[model samples]
Target: MRTGLLLTTLALGLSTTALPASAETLHLFGPFKDEHGATAPIKGSASAMLDTTKNTLTYRFEDNGLSGPVTAAHLHGPAADGQDAGVLAPIDGPYTTRMTGTLQLTPEQVKEVQAGQSYINLHTEKYPDGEARAQLTTDLTGHKHHME
Candidate 1:
């Protein structure tokens, strides 16, 4: 349950009145844990590079222990931590460690990401709902947070 986080944000338009229309980049990261919270402790980490200039969200993942092979991976969103939302995009995978890829993001999706409303979920047969869940954040550090 080590929670060490470093969050740095470089956004073109930080103004409340306007959405960024210029170059923006977000270095976001977080750790993966059992979706049911403390029911089963899995280990992993995920990182993301959201570049508005390219309209792409590049995500990378590291898996330590999972109940089973990943059945699916996705960027689920428009919700806050501990909440559930529909998949905003599917992460391509034969899923293995260092799972990383770039995904095109809509303007609205970018907004969701910037607002801390999106998360990455890795699904497996043992837990079809989600085996690894990382509430994506601007944090550059922090691998796992244990339930208190």
Candidate 2:
């Protein structure tokens, strides 16, 4: 009986270790305007799931009322809102109003995202600078928020 109990305990421990870590869902949104530095009337929202254990980021973003067709999109980071930073990841696009993709990030990139220094920018033909933008952040509940 003691031997059987020991085997059960060992199996339980191994199973626990094999389980994947919990994923974090990040909420993102933006109301594009010229005041926030956009030259157009674009508006949009986005959401992302970060799987720390797998070092992967999956995201979905959608926007409308762009001044022109979306030419590019990117995850730019290590900067705060009202600031600009270089692109950390490029989003594949010929996007009209929506885009979705997954990316593998380095440890440093993950850290930046967790620290709320990352942002998403959708670029349009008329505004190569950026037609819509939002900064990623976490609220008091530790839930992520993508703020304009």
Q: Which candidate is the best by TM-score?
A: 1
TM-score each candidate: 0.77, 0.71
Residues 1-148, candidate 2, lDDT per residue (tens digit)?
9999999999999988876676455544333333245555556666666666666667777677777777888888999877889998988766757667897888788878777787788777677888677666654343333432
Candidate 1 lDDT, tens digit per residue, 1-148? 1232222222332443355557788887778867854365567777788987667898888866787788999999999888899999999878886677899989899889988899999888878888788877885554453221
Total colliding residue pairs, candidate 2: 0
Give the Å error, residue 69, model 1.
0.5
Question: Candidate 2 at 93: error in angstroms?
Answer: 2.2
The segments of candidate 1 whose C-alpha lies over 4 angstroms from its true place after superposition are 1-21, 140-148
- The 10 consecutive residues of candidate 2 with the worst lDDT sum are 139-148
Write down the lDDT of every candidate, Cα atoms only.
0.78, 0.70
